[model samples]
Structure formats: structure tokens, C-alpha cells
Target: MATKSLKAKGNELAESNKQLDILNGGIFAEGELPFFKDKINEIGHFPLRPKKLEILQINVGYMCNQVCEHCHVDAGPDRKEIMTRETMAQCIEIIRNTGAHTLDLTGGAPEMNPDFRWFVEEAAKAGIKDFIVRSNLTIIRANKKYYDLPDFFKKHNVHVISSMPHYTRGKTDKQRGDGVFDKSIKALQELNARGYGMPDSSLRLDLVYNPSGAYLPGDQMALEADFKKALKEDFDIQFHNLFAITNLPIARFLDYLIASENYEDYMYSLVEAYNPAAVENVMCTNTISISWDGWIYDCDFNQMLDLKVASKVKHIKDYNEDLLNDRNIIISQHCYGCTAGAGSSCQGTVA
Candidate 1:
């Protein structure tokens, strides 16, 4: 959790990125917003860098079943971008050669990718210790073909982390879409029937709790208790753990914040809640994000912002372990989300 002072040069670059403004839906220009950089200056350490990478988190595609209001990926059923088998082969090679123990797969709905199963099978054979699948829940119940996903995930021992904004249908459906909560519950039940989330089962099923509005998430353990109690008492659902994720200011969520006139307040909240201890364990330090087109990024939020890694090996095809390891991560104001409060990442709070 140690950090050097936020140098003048680093602050200048982080707050001056024109690309960041464009990527953030043009709500406000970088440096124009005074929250993130000012807070970092107070805390010391403006632009963060990578540590020894141990996780390869890849976004396989942009096609999703539901277009949620808060979806940072902006994924929808009409989106056609997906990772091909060729790209999967290259990614698998990188995972193998880089000695990354975890292969994290995500997407509009990762299962919606045609080569998802193929990639998982290949990575599993390559000795990946942990395979994390970020699912949208409804996709598993969206079609007959996807119905077998729970069993397939169980077979590969893939850790299932799905988005469930709230335990109540009102809050869940409000953020996602109508009927989403019902479908998600159905899917969770299906997963439970197959040993996932069960105490004695090796299969793990974790639920993600995204803030329903432009706000930071609550305590992870406390929220998990709330979700477990509500779901179990209301619908008899069960899960292993809960990940409380702070919604990054980007994409659809960014647009929502601006529209609702809460953008500045939310950014201030993130800056004020800054936790330096969380910086050391930020997902980017240990994880490398791969976009569907094979581009490399520091994290999924960075990927969404088109903040390509500062490394020369910025694509999966190139896959340079040393250059990536030595390079500084591309940072912007959006990084506040990852360093705020307990700090948000793909695995929930870092602190």
C-alpha cells in the first residue's frame, strides 16, 4: 500500500488526456473535472503501474442478451463483435507462455461468443488454475443452447461471477431490465441445483452487486449478508459470495450520471473515499485485460475507455511478457473508481 508522491509530470498527463474525454462520452474534458487528479495529488501517486501479472482477463465479445442501463460495455443483442477462434488461440498461447494462473473471460455475455466453450476448453487444458466467467445470468436462461452452461461451468470448475444488482426485483430490474430479476433468480436456482454455491461443492457461484445508481458500493460482507438473507428468505436462492463493485464513470453509466446531474457528485464521492491501501491490489497490477479484437489494456474499465496498455506489447498477438511487465499502466480520472473506498475490481473490494 506504499506510494510515492504524485509527481507533477504524472498528474499533467493523467488529467490532460484528450482521448479520455472522448472515451468518457464527452461529458467533461480531462483536467476540466477537478476531482480525481486533485485527490490523487493529496494522496500521492497519480498514475499507477503494473506489478507481476498473474491474471489474464479477456473480453471475448460485445454481444449481450440484455442492454442494461448501467452496462459499461454497452453490450446488446444486436452487437456483432465477437472473438474468433484465431484470436482465442493467440490468447491461449499468451496465457500458457505468461504463466498466468487465472484466465478471466467476460463479454456482452461471454457465452454468447461462438468460441467461448472452445476457449475455455483450451485454457483448461493449458493448466489454468482458475477460470473466472463473468456472466449476465439471463443469458444462461435465454436459450436452450445456453441452458447447459451451469453444468458446463461445473465440469471445467470455472468460478461463476454474475451481475445481480440487487436481491429485490424492483431494484434489480430497474438497473438491468424488466423481467431480468426473475430470469436471474431462475438461473441462480439452476446453478444451485447443480452444486454451485453449495457448501460442500467445489463449484463456486459468486454474485456481483453493482451500485444501482451513481454511487459507491457498500461493505462487501454486509451486502453479501443482505443479498443472501433476502434471496434465501424470499426465493430460497443461495450463493457462495458477493462482490460489491463500484460503477466506474464510463459508457452508459457515465451518460446516466450526466443526464441525472449526479456526475460531479459521484466523482467527488470516489475521490473523497480514496483508499491508498487498495492501490497495491488494484486488479490491473496483477491482471492484463484483452479486448475482443486482441488489444491489451490495464483493466476492463480501461479497455472500455480504449486506454490501451502503455506497453509495446499492446496486443495478444504480440504477447511480450517483459515489456508488459516493465511498462507503466495508462491512468486517467476514471481510475478513481478502482481506488475509491474499499476499492472496486473484478473481484470486489481490494482493501
Candidate 2:
């Protein structure tokens, strides 16, 4: 009887998710209201404190193939926002001056940008120690022009990190879209064939995972093991480390919480699980997020919310490392998601 009841609940949840997909029109659909309101209230407003900007993360555009349910960026196919070459030039100038070790490029699909390859080559020429691109694998297979991205990435020795919500096709498709899983799988195989994620390949390939619901993610290490085992067994896929990120309570996710009547409960979950220690390793402390328009933020999550770094230097041209380093990290209810459990960040758990 208990097992039957559990199954019933699961079925109900799945049905609800299907309805949501239809209502919102995609997997990572946009939601109304801010998901981190309570957490923000609890934590109060705080400024961002930069710790020697080792990384310069740039948002090349806001266009994407899939709109996942939990996407804070709210990026989608219809988004018209794309970073201009002029902006890229400014970013390059900063790279030359700051000597930041890593240049992390992101977008609806960074590869979709006309100047993406150009930027990669330029950054590489600057002798940046690490060049990271956050890709949504399907884009690599969406067009013939993008077919050679894996090769180009390998040639430049760019570290590739991609979003793969689940190992199973059903869940992946449900979160991304129909046919997305197949393409992502093919893309991963291509990358793997090019020495990525291989035993000793220097061309690194990492996968990212976020929960499919309002709840925080489970153990990162354990989830990674499951993904590794399932992908390898099911599709003969191989990859390096898996990054388990918690879904921030903002954008479409926040909309889902309110629509599903789970907003309060979700907030309670994060608050109850908050670990002070997690704050010490919050990604914002170590990383700086740059918007396509040149606005700077404590981290990517803040950028999505239009929460700029609490410093006089909000844009790249006016970047003041000392002032940013001395400011306090901006805190809000959304932070609980990062501080919960083992903690979560773009790189995975903070703890």
C-alpha cells in the first residue's frame, strides 16, 4: 500500500510537470515573481567583495535552444540580446590588463555568436591560463556550422563544461526538450572521441547537473557517480568530473514555485538547511560575473536578477579591483540555495 501511494504521488508530480511544460511552452520555462524574496529578506542587503578577480566570466548572448524550467538567465530561442563585437573588444582589453587566469564564456549558446570563435582565439592569444566555455550541447548539433566546435575547442585547449540534467533520456528530454537528449549524447560522444574526459586527456570536459524541481540538489559526489555510471553504461558516454549545482530561486523557477504553491515550502527548506560555513566558499567571493552589456555582479545568479556589484565600478571599463575586493558580498534569500546541504555554485558544492 505504501509503495502504491508513493507511485501515485510520483505519477501526479509527473502529470503536473507535463501541464507546466504546456503552459510555459518549454522545459526550463520562465516563472513569475522572484524566488529568493524571503531569503533576501532574512539575509538583508550586502555588497559584493571581490577576492582578486581570478576569473572573468562574460555573457556573450542571451539566446538559447532550450529553456529549462529552472533557468535563471531566462535565455531562450526568441531572445534577441547578443553581445556586440565592440563589447568583446572592451572585454579583451580588460583581459590584457587584469591578467585574470580564466576567461569563462557563456551565453544562450556561446557558439551561436558570430564572433565566438574569434573571441576564443583572441583570449587564447592573450595567454590566459584557462579558457572555459559553458555550452548547452544541443547547440553544437543544431547546425552544421557549429559541428566543428569540439575540434576548435580541442585545438585551443578550451575547457568545456556543459549542462546535462540527467543521464536518462526521459528526464533529460523532460527538462530540456524532446530530441535534446539524443543530440546532447551525440555531442558528448564527439567530445569524448576527441580525447575529452578520457583517462589522461588534457582537453577537459565536465558536465553540470541541477535538480528538476523546487527542492535543493542531493549530494554532489553521489549524484556525479550515478551520472557517470548511467551514462557510461547506457550510452558508452564518458566525461570528467560532474558539477552538481543547486537551482537558484529566481526567474522561471520562482514563477514555478508560486504557480505550484511550493514557494513558501521551498524557501523554508533552504533556510532550515543554511550552513554558515557555506558562505565562506560562495562562488561570488572568488569569481566575478560580467554581463553582456559590461555590468559586473558578484556572481552569475546576481547578474540574472540585475543585482550589480555594490561598488562604484559596475562596468568593465571602470572596473576597480581594490574597491570590489573590499566590498561585502551581496546577500539575499536566494543565497540559501548556495549554502544548503554541501552548498552549490557554478563549480558545484561550496563545502
Candidate 3:
């Protein structure tokens, strides 16, 4: 088991190295790929800007338990970047001042943050309308100490959004790690026992799905049906909703695309499937992504690419709602990923 795990880690490192090469090689340079602005302009919406700051997506850290093949964050257990209490305090202040309805907490595993529970407890006290935790599922069952997470989540009413690559163990384990499938199942059952996803229960649990390869995800409703049926019959698990997310071309997935000779094809696919309508409701329009160190970006993908918001005020300490409200979004060819097909965001399809 250790040998297989080591081999997987080696492969992950190799892909990450390849992705760094491609990113450093100027994959975002003009003419290297289709300009996102051109496509939007052709449709008569040239420069995209923020609509309203409805969701503040805070990336608390990059320390994770597993290294998935398609992770855009390139996060793992080895990552040292974790959000400090000072920075999180600044974020909470912004949330209070801005009255942002939803606090979307994300990370390598947001729960893995040493101060995660404290943050949640305080944030709830601040009266934020909704608390969304983007979990990896397996983390809850990763250790004996984490076993109480379900009850903890219930106590705080934290809406759990987990990533389940596929309903089947084979595809899921392939994309995630070797034994991830079994762990995820146990974790889901635990969540179910806690009234999460139960009919008429206020505690909501949603699962997110992203294609394991370069292709876009299938229809959200259809895929959700399949996931619901399979999980219920096979494991007797219950969940509220399934969100189908399109994999953006970046990080390990970018490396996979280039290594498999699918880089250009995948980029073009995003550009080709551009939905003009999807642009109006893209998550970036209402969401602001904050890195662990407090720098701001239009979305999580932009954060990974080191693309800050176009506004002069770029950090949480200097967060200016007036400046950010009307500021033009910083975008590139990668923007196509969010606008393609049914559209993709942390919430799921836009159009």
C-alpha cells in the first residue's frame, strides 16, 4: 500500500512539474490561445465587471490529505500555506461590513485548518446568513479526531459541499487516491446519520462532480439523478443535490492535458462551447476569491494563476467595496472554462 501511494505521489509531482513548465512557457500570452475578451466582445459584452459582492470565497489554506489528479489548487499535505487568524479576522470584518450573505470557505481542506472550528463558530456569531464548507468528504473519516465532524457540522448548521468524483469506486479512486472510495462512502453514511440530506431536514448536504478528464461535465439534472440513485441503492446514502462542474484548464489537469496531447484541444473546447448567456451569471460577477495570505482575485482559478482583481485595492486589509463593485474583472483565455456549455462555477451550471 505504501509503495502504491508513493508511486501515485511521484506521478502527481511529475504532472505538477509539467504544468509549471506550460504555465511558465506563457500559455496565457496573447495569440497563444483565443482571447476571452474577443469572444465576449463579439457577443457585444466586452469587459466583464462585478455585479454585487454576494459570496466571499475564502481559501483558508492549501494543506490537504489527498492529491487528486485534476486538482486546480495543486494542494496536498505538504503545502505550508494556511490562512492566519489575522487575515481571517480581516475577512470577517469585510463580511460584516459588506453583509455578504454566504461565506464560502474552501482550502486544501478547510476543515484541516487548525482554527477552522473557531472560525466557523465566530463567523456564525457574526450572523452571516449561510456558511458553506467545501469539504473533500474523506477528511471527516481521515482520523479518529475528525470522526466528530458530522456532529460538529450539524451543531453549526454548516452546509457541506463535498467533491465526489463519481458514484462508482473505480472511477473515483482513479481520480482521487487508491482507497478514497471506501473512505468517502463511510463519511457520507456518517453525514446521513446526522440528519444531513434527510427529507424535510434543514441541514443540507450537496455533492459536487467534475469530469475526471478534459471533457466538460454532463447535464447537472441527469447526472444528479444517476448519482442519487446509485448512492442510495448501493450504499443507502442520501444527499440533497449534485453539482456538475466543468474542469478548468489549469494546474495538474493542465499538465494532464499537455502530457496526453490534449492541451490545445481542451482549450479550444472551452472556447468553442462558450455560452454568451453564461457570462452574465458567472460566479466571478458576484464572488470575490481571497487567497490564504489575503490577496483577492476574481475567482479561485484566477487565484491559482496569480491573477489579482483589476482594482488597485487588492488585499483584504485594503478591501474597498465601492472600488470592487464596478471594477472590470481580470480575465484571460481560461475564462472560457466558466462560460462553456451549461457553464460552471462553485455552485454548478449558470445557464
| Maximum-TM-score candidate | 3
Reference-based lDDT, residue 304, model 2: 70
* Steric clashes per prediction: 1, 12, 0
lDDT of 2 by residue, 291-347 (tens): 888898888877876778878888987876776667766666677788887888888
Per-residue error at 324 for model 1, in Å? 0.8
Residues 89-152, candidate 1, lDDT per residue (tens digit)?
9988887777678888998899999889999988888878888999999999999999999989
**lDDT of all predictions:** 0.81, 0.77, 0.84
Error of 3 at 319 (Å): 1.7
Better of 1 and 2 by lDDT: 1
List runs of model 2 lying over 4 Å from the truth: 1-48
TM-score, candidate 2, is 0.86
Candidate 3: 10-residue stretch with minimal lDDT: 1-10
For model 1, state the Cα shift of residue 260 in Å: 1.0
Deviation from native of the Cα of residue 85 in model 1, angstroms? 0.6
lDDT of 3 by residue, 1-351 (tens): 112221235654335344444543454464666578777888767788788688989999988898888888878887778998888888878877774789999998998999888888888777788889999999998999899999999999999999998999889998998989999999999999999988788999999998988788989999999999999999999999998998887776776777789887888788788899999899999999999999999999888877888888899888888887778887766678899998999999999
